[model samples]
Target: MEASPARRPHRLDPAGGCPHAVNARLLARGAVTPVELPGGIEGMAVLGHAALKEFLQHPEVAKNQRHFTALREGRIAAGWPLLTFATVQGMTTADGDDHRRLRSLAGRAFTPRRVEELRPRIERLVAELLDGLERAAEAGGGVADLRRHLALPLPMSVISELLGVDVEFRDRLHHLSSVVVATDTGPADAVAANRELVAVLGEIVAAKAARPGGDLTSALIAARDEGGDRLSHQELIGTLLLMIVAGHETTLNLITNAVRALCAHPGQLDLVRAGRASWADVVEETLRWDSPVSYFPFRYPVRDITVDGTLIPAGTPVLAGYSAAGRDPAAHGADAGRFDVTRPARPGSVRHLSLGHGTHYCLGAPLARLEATVALERLFTRFPGLGLGVPEAGLTPHAGFVGNSVHALPVLLRR
Candidate 1:
C-alpha cells in the first residue's frame, strides 16, 4: 500500500506565487531593494544574510511603535492595529534599555532548567494528541487532518498550559491571534478580533494578579528586571499576549513546513526514515529551505545608514526578508533551493535568519526547537505509512505577510 514515488508531494504551484522567490530575486539584484509596505510606506528590504545581519545589528534601527514609519504617518489603515500594537509593550517590540529590561525578565522564565522540566510534559501531550489522531484515522477511513489533530493543537496546548490559560479560552485566543498575523483579514474582523484579544488578556492578567499560580503568567506578574523595574499593567497584558501567540505560531509553522518539505522529497524522507540523516538535520535544513517566518516587518533607522552600498535614510522602515536570506545563492551556493536532508555543514554557507538575530533573538527558541523535533520524530514513527491525502497543488498557502505555512495538511495516517 506504499505510495508510489511519483505520488510524492511536490513544490508549490508556479502560479500560486512564493514570497521567498520574490525576495530572492530582489536579493540577486542587490542586497537592499526599495520595497513598499501596507499604507504606502516606503522602505528598504534587507535581502541577503550579510545585509540582514548588518541590519539587525545597526544601532539606528529600533523596534518600538513610536518609530514605526507607517504608524507615525497615520497611514496604518484599519485591519492592522492589532498586529501593530498587540505586543507593543513586550520585548518583541521593545528596544534599547527597555528591551534589555523586558528581555532579561522574560529570559528568566525560559531558563534551561525550566524548559528542560517541561520536556516530559510536552512529550506526554504529543502522545495524547497522536492517540487521538490514530483514533480519528481509524474511525474516518484512514485520513486525518494533521494540521488540526497534530501540528496545531500540540504547540497551542503546550503554550496555553505554560501560561496557565484556561482550556476554554484557547479556541478564541487562537482565532484572535490568527487574525492579528494574517495580512488578508478583513478590516472589520481585525478590529473586532483586536478588541477581543486585548479584553481577554486583561481578564487573564487580572485573574493572575488576584490569585498567583505556579505558571509563567503569575511569574511575569511578579517578574522584575535587574533595575528593580517591574512590568506595568499594560506591559503584563502585552507580554502575556506576546508569549501566548508567539509561543505557538512560529513553532506551528516550523512543524508544518518541515513535514511538507520531507513529504515533497521522498528521497530525503527515505534518508530520514532509514536513519541516515538525523531529525535535527531535517529541522535545520527546513529552516533554511522553507523558513517558518517568511519576513519580519518594520525596523526603523535611528539615523541614516548605508548597507551593502545602498543608503537608507533616517526613520525609513526596513523589513528583514528572513526566508530570502535563507536561500541566498551567494551565501548558500547555487543549490540553495534543493531540499536536501544530507546537506553538508559547509563554510561560507548562509546561516538561516528564520529565528532573528543579535540581542532580540527569539527567547523561546529552545522550547520551539524541542517541540518541533519531538513532534516530527514521534509523528513519522507513529504513522510510518503517512502520505498526502490531498495533492500538493491543492494545498492552501498561509495567507499572511509573514509565515510560510500551509492552511492544512490532509494526510493519510496509514496507506
Candidate 2:
C-alpha cells in the first residue's frame, strides 16, 4: 500500500514523462529523438545507453556551452544568466587548451592523498552531526529534519574549511547559491542574487590575496600569480565560485538522496540493516536510480552529427540526460528502474554518467565520494532506528531541472 522509493514523487507525470525522464519509449523505437523545450526551442534528445554514452564521448559535441552562435544569431534572449550558466567563465565553460589548463590547476586540490587525508575529519563531522541530530530529535519530541541537521551542514562545513572560507560567510553563500540554482526564482531576484554573489566572492578573493593561507583558495591565488597572466582575474573568481557551488551542492544531494532512497525501500534497507549490503552499494545504486543531478545543461555540437537516424545539426544545444541514462534498460537490464542493493557486481559493469564522463568529468568526484561514503556509513551505523518522519509524497522537490533533490528530508532520528 505504501509508495516505493523508486516510485517517489516527481518520478513520473500523468503523461509519463517525469521532469527529467528520458524518452525510454522513444529510445526503444530509435536512438535519437526530436523534442521541444520550454521556450519553443527545438533540440535533439539522445536516448538509450549506447547513444547517450557515444554522445558523451563524441568530439563533435562541444562542451563550450556559451551558445555563442545562438547569442549572435539571436535565437535565445541574452537576458539574466540562468543558474546553470552562472559560472560561465569557470572551468566548466572552458574548451580545448583553456579547459585542460583550468582542470589541471583545480585538479591539484582533489588528488587521492588529499581526499584520503579528509576521511577522519569527515567521520568526526558526521559523528558530531549525529549527536546534534539526536539532541534535535529529543527537543522536537522524536522528529528532526535530517537534511538540515546533517545532509546540508556536513558538506557545507567540509567545503568551507577546505577553501578557508570563514564560518560567518557560509550562511550567505548557501542562501545565494540556492536562489541561483532554483528555477522558480524570479528574474529580478535572480539578478539581485547574482550581483550579491559576485560581490561576496570578490571580497573573499581579495581577502585571500592579502594573506594567502594554506587553503585551496590561497593555492589558486598562487597558481595565478606564478603563471604571470595565465589565469585571468575573472578566471580566478570564476574558479572559486565553481568550487564553492559545485563542491557542496552535489554532495548535499548525494547524501540526502541516498537517505531518501533507503527510507522508501524497506527490503533494501533491511539488507543494509542486517549487514548484507555495504553503504557503497547504496550510494552507487542511488546515483544510478535517481541521479543527484537530473539534467546536465547545454552541450552543443560543433558540426552536424547523426545518432542512430536523427541528425543533430551543428551549433544546436543538446542536454545530456544522465537522469535518463541511469535507467536505460538496455544498459542495466530490464528491471533497471528497480532499486536493489544486492545487485551483483560484474567485471565490466555499466557506469552511471551521473558525475559525468570524459575530460569535463567532475573534479570533485573523489572528494564527493569520500564525503558521501563516510557520512552515510556513520549515520546509519550510529542510529540504526532512523526512518522517515513524513510521508513519501509530502517531500518537497527542488524547483529546477538542474538539481534532482528535495528541499528537505525530515526523519525520525531514533525510534
Candidate 3:
C-alpha cells in the first residue's frame, strides 16, 4: 500500500491566551503555545519561522468562507447589516478556481507596471494633502489631526482614482465601509449599507460600460464586454467593492501606523527626517513593529489534523495573528519589539507576516508599499519639525480587527 498523505497539525487549548499576550511571551522565549480564540477550535497557532513557512505555504489551508456565521451573528446583535455590500461583493471570500480566475483578472490592473506609472500621480496627491496639512497647522495653532487630513484621505483618493469613482463621494462610501467592518453595528444596518453600496456600484458599472474610460472600472467592463473573460454582474460588483474597501482601508491603517510608530520612536523619526536612513527600512520596520492588519480569519482543518502534536477536528474556524508573528522573538531575536530602523538586513531581515503568506498573500502589497513610502517621504520633507501635538495617551485607538489605528493623529507642522 502507498504511504498515507501528511496530516496538518493542530493544537488543543493552543496557549489559552489572547494574541497580544502570546506575542509578549513569544518575544521573550522565541516561541510559545498556539493561541486559541475565546471559543475553542478557533485560534491562531503561533509558530516560528519554520512552522510559519510551512503553514503559510501549505496547500491544505484555505481562507475563503461563504459566510462568517460567528462574525455575522455578532454584527447582527450589534445592529449592523447581515451582508454588507462588501460581504456580498468582495473577492477575499472567493476560493479555489473561482478565486484564481478573479485574481488573475484583477492582477492585470494591479500590475507593478501600472502601479509604477501611477507613482507621480500619487506623489502629486501627497503634495496636495501636505499643503492642506500645512494650512491646518497654521490655522489651528500648529496642530492638526494628521489622520483626518492625510492618512485617511491619501489612500482613499488613490483608490478612488484607480476605481474611477468620484473622490467627492469618499465620505459616503467611507461610511458604508465602516458599517461593513464594524462589529458594533447591527446586521440590519450593515445589510442596508450593503444594498446601497451595491446599487451605487451598479450605476457606476452601467455608466462605465456605456462610456468606457481608462480606469480600472473601465478595464473590468472592457474585459466583460470585448475581452473573452466575461465577468458576471455579481463578480464585477464584488471585485469593485473589494478593491475600494481593501485598497483604502488597509492602506489607511498602514499610513497611520507608520506615522504613530515614528512619533513613538523619536530616534527612528529622527533617522527618517535626517535622510540618514533609508525610508524603505523605516517603512519595513514600522510594518513589522505594528502591522496594520493584525489578525486575519482563516478556516481550520478540512480533516482531523495534528499541529505541533495537538489534534483539531475539521471545519473549525481559526484566526492567524500576523501581528503576533512579527513580534515573535524566535524570528527576530531578543529585540523583536524594538523599533530600530537602522537594523541591518539579514536572511529573514524584513520577514513579517504583515502581507500574509501562502495563497492568500495580499495582491496590493506593492502598491501599498509605494503609497506609504511616497506619503511618508513627502510628509517629512514638507514638515521637517512635525511632532505629535496631543499626548500619546490621548490618541484613540481604533477598535475591532487587526488594525492598529488611532482616530486622530494630531501633529504640529512646524518646519
Candidate 4:
C-alpha cells in the first residue's frame, strides 16, 4: 500500500530552510501554502503582494510576542522590554497613536542634522580602526581578524560614546548582548543576561543623570527633568539599551557582511576598490544580499486578519523575514537574488529591508550608513589588496534573533 502524502516527511528539512523555501513551496502547490514550522510555531503562509502588505502592517499583529516559544519556552526574553516599553513610549509595537508619540521623540534625537554633526567623529573612528587593523596585520604577518580589530570594535566604540556606556565595560556589554539575543537559549538564561544588562545600563543612566554629559543619554535625562514629555527611569533604561544594542550589533554585521561579500565576489570588490562604485552602493548592495538581520521576530495581531485570503487569528505571532522579503521576486523581480551595485534606486524599490519600514523604521539609519560607508571606504583604500584568509564556507554565521555576523573575519592586508 502507498504511504499517505500527509504522513510523509517533508523533502525540505525545515532546520536548514532558507528564505527561498517559501517561494519553492508556493511554486510547487501553484498557490501559497502554509508549510508546517518545526516545534509548532505557526507555518508562514507564503505571502505574495497583497499578503505581504497586509501582514506587515496588520493592526492585530504584535511583533513582540514569543514567536519562538515552542523552540525554547513560552517565557519571553528580557530583550522584549526594548520593544514592549517602546510600545508604551510610542515606538511601533502597534498601529495607533502610541507609535506616533514614541517615533516623534526618537526622531528628535536621530534627525539628519544630528547624523550630519556626527560625521566627522565617525570618520575619525573609522580611521582609527584602520590604523589599528594595519598594526594587527603587521603583527600577524599581514593577516588579522577584521571582525575584531575593525568590524566589532568600531561600532561598539561609537555606540558606547553615543549612549554613555563606559568604554571600559564594552567587552562585558558585548557578551551580554550576544547571550540576550540568542534564539536557541532558554528564557531563564536570557532573562539573567538581560538583568545584567539592565544593571549595567542603570549605572550608566545614574551617572548621566548626575553629570548630564554631552551624549544622547544625558539629553534623554534632561528631557525627563524638564517634565512635559520626560522619560521615566524604565523608559530611559529601555531606550538606552535599545539604542546601544541596535546601534552596535547591526552596524557590526553591516561592516563584517560587506567585507565578506566583497571578498567572495571579487569582481564587485574590484569595482569598489577602483572607485567605479561608491561605498554607498556597496553598503546598499551588501544589505540586500546578506541583510544584517535574518528576521524581525515581533508582531502582534490587533484583530483577526486575513493575509492572502488565509486567516491569521488575532494576537498570533507573525515573523517578518526581512531577508526573505528583500529577495522576494514579486517585490524585486526575477533577478532579485542578484547583487547589482549599479542597480538604480527606483521610487518604490524594495531590494533592501535592512532598515525596516512602515511605522517602525530604524532610528539610527543615518548614523549606521555614515559609519558603514566611511568604514568600508577607508578599509578597502587602506589595504588595496585585502582578501579573506579563510574560505567563505569556513566563516561561522552568528546564531541569534537580531544579527547575521561571522565569528571572525580574518583578512590579509596586501598593502
Worst 10 residues of 4 by lDDT: 1-10
lDDT of each: 0.77, 0.75, 0.68, 0.66
Give candidate 2 regions above 4 Å deviation.
Answer: 1-31, 66-68, 78-87, 227-229, 345-349
Better of 1 and 4 by lDDT: 1
- Considering TM-score, which of the candidate structures 2 and 3 is the better prediction for this target? 2
| lDDT by residue for model 4 (1-415), tens | 2211222222223223234454444533422234443233453443353345556655556544333333235433344422332232225343455456545656776788988887899889888888898899889988899999988888899888877778777998898887765555455675678779889888887877788877778887777677764456666666776777788888988899888888878888777667788889989887876678755555655565556545555544454555555566666678766777776665765546668766677888888888899898888888778899888778776764345667789998987
Writing each residue's lDDT as its tens digit, candidate 3 over 1-415 gives 2323333333322112124554575434332244433233234453454455556655655545433444534532333222342144345666678778778878876788988988999999999998898889889998998988888888888888888887557788877776666434445675687778788888888878788788889888776766554577777988888788788888888888888888778788887667778788877887777777655555445555555444434454555556777777767778877888887655854467788776767888888999999998888777777788988878776755435566678987867
State in Å the error of residue 60, model 3.
Answer: 1.1
Flag clash pairs in model 1: 60-302
Clashes of each: 1, 0, 20, 16
Q: Where is model 4 more than 4 Å wrong at Cα? A: 1-54, 59-95, 226-229, 273-275
In candidate 2, how many Å is residue 129 off? 1.3
Off by over 4 Å in 3: 1-52, 66-90, 225-230, 273-276, 348-350
RMSD of 1: 7.6
lDDT of 3 at 68: 44
lDDT of 2: 0.75
The count of backbone overlaps in candidate 2 is 0
* TM-score for each candidate, following the candidate numbering: 0.91, 0.90, 0.84, 0.84
Sorting all predicted structures by lDDT, with the top scorer first, yields 1, 2, 3, 4
**Of the candidates numbered 1 and 2, which has the greater TM-score value?**
1
